[model samples]
Target: MILYIAKRLSAGIVLAVLVTFLTFLLLSTSFQDVVRTILGPSATPETVRGMMAAKGWDRPVVVQYLDWLSHAVRGDFGVSVYTSLPVGPSVLQHLAVTLSIIIPALVLTGIIATLLGVWAASRGGAADRFAQGISLVGYLVPGLLLAIGLVVIFAVQLKWLPATGFTPLTEDPSAWLRSITIPVIVLMIGGIANMAAQVRGRMIDELRQDYVRTLRTRGISTRAIVFKHALRNAGSPALTVFSLEFIQMFGAALIIENVFALPGYGSYAFNASLQGDIPVILGITAFGVLLVVVVNLLTDLVNGWLNPKARVR
Candidate 1:
């Protein structure tokens, strides 16, 4: 187990480095364009050259990447090109706001989807139809549309929750919950649409296996057989789906945050892109790469724990 985890971690580290370096190389090639955008086309050639030299854009791409990587490794991702704020701290602060909504939504999605899927797979009639119906509706409806409707009914009509803006969890717990609830629900619906069907399909296959029949003949309770044996066996695939759902949730949170007017990582990244803020963009890319690597590593570890064969594979 230890060796397996170590191997996965090493692979993740290598992947992160490769991804960041490639991103840096691609961005570096566009340095002149970025400078032109920042300084405006009216600037003289000398002024542009001076700015490039000041930012070390004239340096070798490899050297520039090394310098950035060295600082990034120390959690000093330089400063934002537009704001002059430290990129690392700013990115992390916004990331915290994004996660505040994403994490809770993920947890709720997992629990509810798993139960709904397992029950649908076991009952195999109206329960199955109902689960499929929910998934279909979730998929067919646009998330933005759903968010707007929710805001109208819950925030505008009833005034049960705030329509826009976010409150920090540290400031007021109740307000934080109210601010995040609508966004969370939007994410949950999308996540469950993907995961519940995956779980139900996997569970159905597991319950039909020969081992399940033997367990039944051995007088195991249906609940025990389903929950303990079948669910455990089905977990490896379900976990894969769950991990993928997490990545999708991260992306969806960006759009959802905009709809809700939340100040978050998505908004930060969006603004940086519009302004051609390379340092902030690079910082966000590095952080996003590392985050993806970490999530995949954790997912692999969980998979190995659930299916011993996965460790060897």
Candidate 2:
């Protein structure tokens, strides 16, 4: 297990480095004179050139990426060209806010999906059909449209929560919850849609296996057969589905955060992109790629642990 995990981890690191280099290369080469974008159509050539020289942007692209990579390795991601603030701190702050919204949504999605899937698989009745229908619709809906509809219903009409914005948990716990609730629900709906179906299908397949029938014939309770035996058998595929869904949730948060006016990593990076702020863009891109790679690696480790054959495969 240790060796398998180590192998996965090493692969993740290499992938992260490649992603970072490619992102850096593209952003650096494409957006020439971010200073002009920063200063807006007003800055003169002399001013722009002076500013670029001051910021060491006049250097060759390779030299710039190498320098940035070295600094990024030491936890300094340079300053945000958009905000004139330290890139690392700003991105970290935004990441914290984003996680506050994303984590609860993911946890709720998992718990609810698991329960719904298990119930639907075990029962297979009207409720199961309803769940299946809901999942199908949810999987098909665009996240942006869902977020908009939610904001209109919950935030605009009902006035139960703020329409869009972010509040730090440390500032006021209740306000923080109120702020994140809408975004959470939006992301949750999409996740639950696909995840429940995944769980239901896997559980159904597990329940149909011969071992399940053997356990049932031995007078094992349905609960034990489902939860203990069948559920464990179903878990390998479920883990894979859940991991991919979580990654999707992370990507969806980018758009959702922007729609909600939340100061998340996604929103920050997005706003920076409009202004062509390369450093901040690079920071967010590198961080997001690394996050996805790490998550995938962890999922592999978990899958390997659950079924040791996976490690060799």
Candidate 3:
């Protein structure tokens, strides 16, 4: 098991490096004059040329990438050309803002969806139908639309939560919740719907197996049979999708953060892409690659732990 984990982690690291390379390649291919963008409309041609030379932006793409990568290895991601701040600290603050919402959305969505799915699957009638409806709605609706609708309902009309902006947790935890609640809900919808549907289907299938019948025949309680035995088997299959929800949450966060006016990594990335801020963009991409790789590695470990059969491989 330890060797399997070690191999997966090593592979994840390699994949992260590949992802960074691809992201850098794509960004470098853009036509935008990043130096001009930084200096703005008033900058003279000589200034732009000198700036590019000074920053080594005129260098070959591979050379520039290696320069940036070498500095990144030393914990210097370069000063943001636009923000005039160290990319590392800027990225961390933005990343923390993102995580504040994404982590809760992932955990809450998983727990709530799993419980509801178990209930719906066990009941297997109207409950099942309701779960299906949630899946359809979540799957069909775009996250932006969902976020807009939620903002309108909860913020504009109901006035239950703040409509936009964010506050740091250290300053005011309550204010932070008030701000993040809506975005988290927007993120939760897809997660809950997808996870619930997966759980429902897996449990239903598990319940139908002969072993489940035999367990029931041996006079086990319905709860014990469904939850203890069938649930374990059912849950193993769902971990793959559960792991996928991490990525899903990140994607959803991109839309939700913008709509909600949160200055998170998603919003930063969005603005950076528009401005051709390669340093910020590359920083975020590198972090995202590492995050995704880590999530997958953790998922593999969890799935293996849950299913003994998976551990042998």
Candidate 4:
């Protein structure tokens, strides 16, 4: 198990380096545009050259990436070109806001989707159709439209929740919950649909296996056969989908945050991209790559727990 974990960690490290390097390379290609945005298009060629030289923009991309990586290892992500503020702290703060909603959404999605999927698979007929219908509706609706409609009904018409803005959980837990509720729901809808469908399909497959018939003949309770043996076998694939849902949620956050006016990682990253804020963008990119690595590692661990044979692979 230790060896397996070490192998996974090493692979994650390599993946992080490759992802960040590629992102950095792509961003570096836009250096000229970034400089123009920073210095303004009206600036003279001499002034632009001076600014580029001052910022070490003329350096080779490899050298620049190495320098950034060294500082990143030391927890120094540099300052934002647009805001002139430290990138690490700002990125972390906004990320915290984003995670506040996303974490809850993900947990809820897993639990609810699993229950729905298992129920649907075990009790096919109306129950299966119901689950399929819900999943289909969630897939058909656009997240942005769903978010807007929710805000209109719950926040605007009924006044049951805040329409925009966020409150720190530490400052006001009730308000914080209210602030994140709609956004969480929006994210959850899409995630649950996709995850539940995958789980349902896997469960159905597991239930049809010859072992299921043997278990029934051997006097194992139907519930035990389904939930204990079948669910465990189905879990490995379900978990893979669940892990990917985290990344999907992160992408959806950009739209959800903008719609709800939450100060979150998505909005921060979006603004940074628009202004070509290299330091901030790179900081967030590194953070995102690190997050993906960690999530994948966790998923592998969970998969190993579900199926010991997976560890060797």
Q: Pick the candidate with the highest TM-score.
A: 1
lDDT measured at residue 202 in model 2 versus the true structure, 0 to 100: 92
lDDT comparing candidate 4 with the true structure: 0.94
Question: For this target, which candidate reaches the highest lDDT against the unseen true structure?
Answer: 4
**Candidate 4 regions with alpha-carbon error over 4 angstroms:** none
Residue runs of model 1 more than 4 Å from their true location after superposition: none
The weakest ten consecutive residues by lDDT in model 1 span 245-254
Clashes of 3: 0
Model 4 per-residue lDDT tens digits across residues 1-313: 8998999999989988898889889988888878888787798888888888998888999999999999998999999987799999999999999999999999999999999999999999999999999999989998999999999999999999999999999999999999999999999999999999999999999999999999999999999999899999999999999999999998888998999999999999999988889999999988998898899999999999999999989
Residue 101 lDDT (model 1): 91
> Candidate 3's C-alpha lDDT?
0.85
lDDT of 1 by residue, 1-313 (tens): 9999999889988998898899888888788888888898798889889999999999999999999989889989999777799999899999999999989998999999999899999999999999999999989999999999999999999999999999999999999999999999999997898889988999999999999999999999999998999999888888888888888988877798788999898888898888878899998988887888888989998899889899996
Candidate ordering by lDDT (highest first): 4, 1, 3, 2
Q: Roughly what TM-score does model 1 have, to 2 decimal places?
A: 0.97
Would you give me the overall lDDT of model 1? 0.90
lDDT of 3 by residue, 110-197 (tens): 8988988898889978988888888888789877887888888988999999999999999999999999998888888888888999
In order of appearance, the predictions have TM-scores of 0.97, 0.91, 0.91, 0.96
Candidate 2, poorest ten consecutive residues by summed lDDT: 28-37
Count of backbone clashes for each model?
0, 0, 0, 0
All candidates: CA RMSD (Å):
1.2, 2.2, 2.2, 1.3
* Model 3 stretches with alpha carbons more than 4 Å out: 30-32, 39-49
